[model samples]
Target: MLSSNIFSGPIATDAPPASIGSRKDHPVPRLGIAAAAPIQTNKFYANFFLGNQTAPTYLHPYSVFWAGAKDTSGSWGMAISHIDANQRVYGSETNPVTGTPRYYINPVGISSICISAKELGSTTAVTSDALTAFSARIILRASLQGASVIEFPLVQGSAFVTAVFNGACPLIQTGIFYKTVTRSTKEARPGITKYKLYLEDGTTWLLYAHHTKGDPLDLQIINNGLAQAKGPFYGVIQVAKDPGNADSMYDRTCGVYATDVELSGSAHGEKGTYTFNFKKAGMNLTTTLAMFALPHHQTSFDDQTRDKMTDVKLQTTTKGIAIAVVADSWTMVEPSLPVSIGFVPWLPEAGSISNISSTNKTFIHNIAQQEMKQDILAQTDQPSMYFAGKALAKFAVLIMAIHDILGDNNLAQAGLERLKQAFARFAENKQQYPLVYESAWGGVVSTASYANGNASSDFGNTYYNDHHFHYGYFIYCAAVIGHLDPSWIAANKAYVNMFVRDIANPSPQDKFFPVSRSFDWYHGHSWAHGLIETGDGKDQESSSEDSMHAYAIKMWGNVSGDKKMEARGNLMLAIQARSFPMYYLYTKTNNVQPPNFIGNKVAGILFENKIDHLTYFGPQPEEIEGIHMLPLLPHTPYIRARDFVEEEWNTYFANGRAENIVGGWRGIVYANRATFDPKGAYAFFSTPGFDPSWLDGGASLTWYLCYSAGM
Candidate 1:
């Protein structure tokens, strides 16, 4: 069961400010300036408290923003702001005169901008806390305050209320740094800028230029409590040499910053010495890591009892300049079908909290408890999710949500622990992959399987990339869950700067990827999902399936923290409305002839969607003689809540639909593990917000409530 460590919403805790500064509107800022802001750092341990062998990382957070400037060059600019940071410059395009959003300031010359975030621990030395990874969030805002050379924005963690600099300088440093663009898109203008600053913590930082082309070299280290990340601190700094130029170092890529530097070990007993290297390597930024092993002895998983011990392999680039880690392998995820959590043996005790809470449960406590337990048990034999075995991948989201939703430390920690296990299982046998594989767990799981059991993309591309979109979904889900579980991803803390930057200026309203047809856009329409028929021996055909736009939008929102999901979700609803033709049908199943759908006309829709709906050909076979969830749209609405709730929330937090899924947020499918059923009488709604709110919506709700009540 999830440990009950729901983070619930935002907290009221706050930290003191370190220092504040100001900026002016002179339209230009300088280099070597410094700023300080209140940084809160929090650390917690799960492995020790859980009494489990695996040691996990706790989430740490604090906030910082940059303060820089822009020149009248209409090109020279420096992007800076430490807190409430934004990824795009002048990304906020609001016509103030019209009260309509226009654009953010553009192209600030940034020679060097500083960014930082800290988590303030409530008390010294947390109890029974083990950190698996460490991560942070910084919100940078544009402002002009004062002098004292302070160049970043700081937030009073006490209320999440942002604070501008104390004095006014010509520049705003903390948030986003926009570089000058050599060219602009058909609809947007370009930018150019530069700003640099140093830190009192003895770290040197890099700044962006008006015309940005390269990225800074950095490494993020992940460690469990079993070891502390230690490093000998080996590095080489290279730069462009100029005999006549005395400020040569000022214009070129010279290495300057390193944090948590250790000669041989890290906090929490980690000794994997990750080497830091920064310089011009060929035409791109390059980073190299050299880790030293932990002294822990080997043993089978403390609980899993499997003979295969953990194998964490690290691979180097072809040129041997960069190192890539092939995380531990997941035991067997996809056997012949998706892995159902209800039947995953170890889990079901924890149904999704959101689902259970959303359902109109019985008024009585014991009955409600029993109903919840049975809800999970009832669906034991069902497939893990709709398609693409992404269930396990999305499940990682619950961990992040735990610490935020319920504030149940035990349950939240449990979720995080399980998430680590799932990730390890997902990142398996890297050496076994083909030369060009990129998705994290490509080789470990079968990329594809035919009725004859073959790995051929052509025979069935559905299964081929089934265990896909790991990093993509992980980051996205983390963003949403993080809003609640603020400390999500403390362990295996990756850089979220990419996501943080996109919040203010997300994909513009008009930008879009042209899909071949309704289905072929992302993975073809079938990728959304397929309609399942019960009591039928026939396997599901991908063509009957379609990609759930809601699912995609949900993931994108969670990852980006931008509000673009609503529009995307609404767009999918429109497409689906036409796809299913929503008109009611009173059909005599036995005589419902399946359409060969020759020539254009209705067949055009099928061809456009790339669905082989014609596979059944001719009259629809009268097999079940019962009503099942079929598509008039994208996804099949859940007729059962068992899919949403599991024991604690392994299923719920990872879920996508509210009526058909948990929070109507996460996707309806899982990845890397579909090698994996249900009951009761009653009705349930399919699409609540979009579908007919009166009849179809009401009936679907009625059925779902009955199922939840265990009627």
Candidate 2:
């Protein structure tokens, strides 16, 4: 939330005029209060507003055709008037070619006036209540009007209908009405642009103003000029054209308002002082009051506790730069996993039979070394039990292999120690980590550990989704630890087996846990959602994670000497290779293997009933194509189609390698390509400006090296 306080009075009688413009057209004779005439041609006039509730109202009824001119001086002005609904003597503001007025102008109801050098063109209008309806206009005019500034009150007998101003300045400002007992400003902080405007009159009325790089137009308005209010009344105004389509002024525009206008803690000139706070309510001539008075509505949060935790502090520095310190306290938790057994053979020993070029091997080794250094230096005291666990496990595997190749006992010991600590945390249930062993289900379950603390803080949130994806890293880590220290596997095998059972249990006899809940026996690949209902149906976001689950099971089976588990893993891989290309990855417009979901392009997320060729995070080509190749690194041999890999590479990766490849994704793309085009993969990884930060901690040097050697 973001807010700014403003405390000023209504426009003074002697205030300066907005701007001056040279006369462009001949001045017409003033019309009397009562006059009428027939309609005229070659003229355009619109009825902006006409109603009679508390008072008669009419705004911008006159037509100024050439008002959009960009010349030095032109006709630039706005007039607002109110007439009784039954007033028939005054005709429309249309004149004949002879320059004779056809209707009378109601001088008695005229409320506010503004003038400028710029012409106003392309006027749009919207009218709606807060919750059900909203009406506004995006007026596009020459930028020159920004210099003009003037404001005045529209009084009808004893009452002031509204205060109108020459809001046609560099930044457009309007008026709003709000009443509250208390008001304050929220501070600013890195990566977060937030301000708070809270109204404390029984029901809380908050108006949050935010400006950030993601929204450029709003940023421009904030930089140029925000809103300024008078007295205690809140004023609503619109500023800046919509950034989405600048060419079309009729689109969205930035809205700014002040509630319970007041200045506290500091004076205008002094370093730290106090100012006045106003409390009055009879003026109704502002746009702000009209907009917010309607009913307000918002979507309910799934978890109320998941709201942001923010801190705000306002202070003026010695240099008089008023700074507000603010911060958000919500953070994500990382996942954990133990080393597994099947990864041992992939670990390169000293002087092992190697087919990879020294150059490619050196590039892979450098990436591994850099990633290990980052992990070693990182504070693992607080880990996000699921995602981060995969990264940590990859680090352990890479370091163990690096130790074998370089004979660095210290590096291997450090990796082992980290794994031990991570394993102990899960086993002993330290820090109330959410990993639970459900004896009834005969498996281990991860609650909403990744969710921090929210309403969906349970396994049910993810439902049957990603169990294999989440548990695969843990299974792989346990196998690695078993390879290094056989006794450790014996002590932890029971705990490790629980995760394996959760993902790969063949039968449904357990009752508590579903039989292969995520993996679809019919589709041959796992779905990412089992609990949440998307109207379109259940879908899997990451196919790579789906394959990794099966690979982890196979690896775990190898180390634990469970032939049935190992065979199941192999079967799952074979099924995925055949079904994935036909359904998930498409080379042709029509393929029937997956049935009813075939398409010309790969489905970013494949659902039971539909295929959306869009990634959940964004629409980047890498997000769509890169995900399919990620699982290929550890499960390279399982991908039987070299042609499919070639097609994917040629489609998205070949031309824009440097432009498209981004953080974490670079490793996945290049490592997967290593199996087919080892030289190209090495070249990309060794590119001069290649960033080490681009390497995903989940990518293993040993896996890359192993795949490169075979290629």
Candidate 3:
């Protein structure tokens, strides 16, 4: 059970803009979901219900896509693909002779095995009717009025794909062009049928059919390579990758399947414990259940729980290999959750920093006054929500530093008034591109795409891309304003809570939004890609910004006096610290990625099937590494490890290499350097004739100087 205080207050009350309505130009079709409530726009299983519904949905060890649709190879079932390390293809090397390679990518939608029913063919219809946080139900039925209907439950972490047949016969097909299909009867179990499928490449797969309420199935291979069972059957069919001990492994988790996962957590002082309780549908309670645990999960498992782990380790596309663990529940504890730091530079030694030299204080106050004179409207009224929100957050930080660190009440009060006016532009729905409650998919989205008739407008906000990155900055700004003046919270709490619910709603009790929309608890991170179908699954480019989003939630909870919300944010930040080092931030000791690809230091664009060292905007080295370090905040030092930062500096920006960089990237590089060398970073920012162009649109000299000095 979740803590009673996890979510209760303004977030529980759903409020949309008064004049908002559904956009007419969006292309998403409401498939089996009839709630008329808000549907999840960015989740792991979204590819199964979007577009032609043939794109791959990766659930770790196994990935499945609809194959009968026109978008795929035109087969009549669900195609499954699993890739090992040997199956990966490498990109071009940086140096022809001695340099390391740029990337390594796994193959997608190979269809090593296809699970189909005899009644499914060209005239069959496939629809994703039911969806949840961890599983989705894909329905397959023939076009005939009286045809049998089959349902396949695709669950995360389950090694097998289970299909429940209703008056239909099983037909096991393959796009891999199988070389042999052999029926095995070595260990006979009641109500169970077994077969081994061998592909041309010497790969073997195990198929087990469990009899539920009908006669046993007699499957045989005919002239074609596919195996087929006789007609008019009712039972469950399961398919799995045969590592070894096929009989023993199948018997342990024979007739059971995971339907969904229930998540709950609680934080006490500096520690937090979170759990994943699987909801299973079949089999007895004493039966052993098998689920795959990632590297991060395995590292945190207790000694007693780890003793039950098997030696079967399977390769995942992006987040290293997953180990098979036999358990129904998994519990992990984050020992060092960030529970103290507030709206100031964070010091692990003393929580928050206050001491500063008189000279530096005078300089910072002077810079703040100069920057505060500029027009706030011109900075925050842009068409793009990402940039405009960032601008608002930038000024909010400057105002806080002036009031908290420098003790200038009048100057801070003046700037706070202008900041509130700028914030009202979006809260009142009066920006150039106002937001609307997209009734079709059921969350707040920008009207820029619908107005211009382009899906890519505003960085695909209308289609559900980077919602957290766009709205997190505003949440932080609201927290600062509400902290300075508690009276302001009553006027704007609903509007601010709407943005929080759009991205990080913690409970499903609020019917207008899904729970924890952006963060994936299983993956220990949040994904940015949404709605669009791609050869690779979801990808997140900015790990630093991801941490910033979590930091904003923590601060907002503190200001709003929501203890559980604050605790949840602290747990999320701690999880990011543990998971980022294993996958995204590569150290020399890492054994997860390929040996030759570790020299790059950073996983630039991490996709499900590939890890490419580049960004969607450009191929510059500074841009690739700088995306993970922008808008430096109080949580920056806690998330970005010191040793990793030292290695990154030596590898890319050492020996005055950072001095040669131009534009806002120079400031970003200097701010990141402060994690290791505070004095050097302070010198760079406090230079007599500092160029304002060197600062990013979302960064200020006052915040950077104070951060460096405090460190």
Candidate 4:
């Protein structure tokens, strides 16, 4: 009875997703100053402005934070820290000196340089403004003086921490205490002043001050390792760590400060390219821009951009060393994206669904029919949006398989009607824990956490945690519904689009939501941590789910006929395919992670400060590896390589070891193994008397069988 045209006309590209009835203001308490414009809840620099505001925000090679200047003689400034690879302290479980290690950590380093203003004191107030995906501008003002002194631009991947003095003399100080201060008088360029600062630990840094008003650079080194510049300075002051041969490379990019980053990406057919253009600010433009590229970025950089890479390298806490590149813009290309992947099992090369055997098709159909007869309302009516959404998505996949793969239109229709009703409970905001569009942080969130005053309720939904992972399943469900019954899209377009905008709003032009709220363009992946402040910084646990979220976006875009969104989704998937292996999914040959650490196969719970070989729930080998393998969708094989899967299987789940594992984890490991051994997976799922409990709430037997058999 649910028969309808699947491919519908494209919706209006500019039409924003409706906020729906959940636009009511939430009563939950939120910390930090509220922004008049939409606030970015999930971003790299959010730790700086949110919570205590003193926690360091990691920007790869360099990190900066507000110190409050309580200890340093009332000198209010942002503390800058850059730790070397040799400075990493190994975990107690493993030792790098004598034997292989289990973990490594790089604690927050001592500030080498603190850029302040001569006018700033203990009473200076600090606030962040102009926050974007890749940048945050820190403003320091003296409340009594009623004048702003300086603004520090903190970018995610920029090498230099820039200070723009606004009518205040620049005061450069070091917490570690400077051993020597050598002022560079080499007439490198007009209106440019350079200073070489030496620390007690033999660490050297270069400070380049560009004067727009032609003021003479008379920065005097005062007592206690403090340096002060002369009056009414209105120009840029940038500082960078001396990478050994600093005089030549530092001079090329000292004057030009990368204040922000502009991200643009495009996907054409199977090829995808995403570009990061460093928004340069300062007096100099003739010279090239000097910015640090992460290891993943460097590996994917085009030949033209890759050639500009310098030998200078800086160690990051978790992502290995970042290489310094002399270029204004860097574009990474992925020539083979799984653009053809869809709701069904698809082969990228053939650009179509894989041929499934007749026996396997009947086997999948019997399982799907049996699973579809279960009580949908009982499973999907849970209070938690995460679990409820997962159930809804599970059933949606089953219905799709019945129709598309099984060619059983009548059964698919019956199951789809039940699914639509279950989804209606969510779309109408009638679920037990409905969503509310909280304007304070700007996104739709579950009322469960807001009402209960529990931060961990529904996995911190009210606090903007895991928005991508929570809402992505619902989006995928809606996409499948739209694909099956095109008539459904008209009524639910606004509701489903709201979820998309919440997680992956593509443009700032949309005022309702933050642009790319979860995805970090500079890092080539999305971070799950939000609002909650941690010493380690933002982290993402499930690389597979991260890629699945992107695949959902691609499918939703495809069904909705939003070419740009579809293309962006394809591009994001490509980036994740490249980035996940380097940072999260560790193959035996992966040199990106530490040699001792890579033995863990998968980078369990990758944090900015440390990589623990475990998950939040449990430390079991299955749990550690299974978190990234669940809810395996169509394009999973594209991101998760066969080599890594095989290596991981041999490491943990080889020789029937997976069979012994209890609960849903066993299914996850086997589902992941399907990427390499489809025959084995097909046999496992197709076997009679299979335990239904093995499947996760988000997974279905129909999908597992179709995926394996088609492959």
Q: Which has the greatest TM-score?
A: 3
lDDT tens digits, residue span 646-705, model 3:
888888888998998899999999999998899999999999899999999999888899
Where model 1 places Cα greater than 4 Å from the true spot, the runs are 1-413, 427-453, 457-486, 489-549, 582-711
**Model 3 misplacement above 4 A:** 1-10, 17-25, 31-36, 69-74, 93-98, 144-148, 186-189, 245-247, 283-286
| TM-score of candidate 2 versus the correct structure, residues matched by position | 0.47
- Pairs of colliding residues, candidate 3: none
**Could you arrange the candidates by TM-score from highest to lowest?**
3, 4, 2, 1
Residues 193-297 of candidate 2 have per-residue lDDT tens digits of: 222211111112122222221221121222111222221212222221111222111111113222221222211211111121221232221212211100000
Compute each candidate's TM-score over C-alphas. Answer: 0.26, 0.47, 0.95, 0.93
Off by over 4 Å in 4: 1-19, 22-35, 70-75, 94-102, 230-232, 347-354
Residue-by-residue lDDT tens digits, candidate 4, 1-711: 101211122233333334344454544334333255467877777776666667788887888877777434345787888988777877777422224466677867467888887677767766777787778777777753456677877887787888887678777888778888988767446678788898887899988888777585677878756888767787888888986875678777777777777776666667777778888878867677888888788888899999999998888888887888999999888887777788887644544574677888877778887888899988998988889989988998888888988899999999999999999988888899878876666778888876778888898887788888989999999999999999899888888888888888876767777778888888878888887888788888888778878888889988887777777778789888888888999887888887767877777787777877768888688887898887888887788888888998988889878899998887788888888898998888877799988887778988889888877
Greater-lDDT candidate between 1 and 2: 2
The TM-score measured for candidate 4 stands at: 0.93
Question: Mind sharing the TM-score for model 3?
Answer: 0.95
Q: Could you give candidate 1's per-residue lDDT for residues 1-711 as a string of tens digits?
A: 111211111111111111111111111111111211110011111111122111221110111112112221111111221111122232233222222222222122222222211111111111211111111212221222221221111111100111112221122122222232121122111221222223332223333222123321122222110111122111221111111221223233222111111111111111111111111121123322111111111111122212322232211100001111111211111111101111011123333223333333222222222222222112211122122123322333333323333234565455455444433332321211211221211111222232234433322232322111222233333444444345554432222222111111111121111111122211112221111111111122322122222333334443444323323322232233222321111111211112111111111112111212212322121111001121111122221123222311232222422234222111112110110121211122222343223222102222232222322
Candidate with more favorable, higher TM-score: 3 or 4: 3
Q: Compare candidates 1 and 3 on TM-score and give the better one.
A: 3
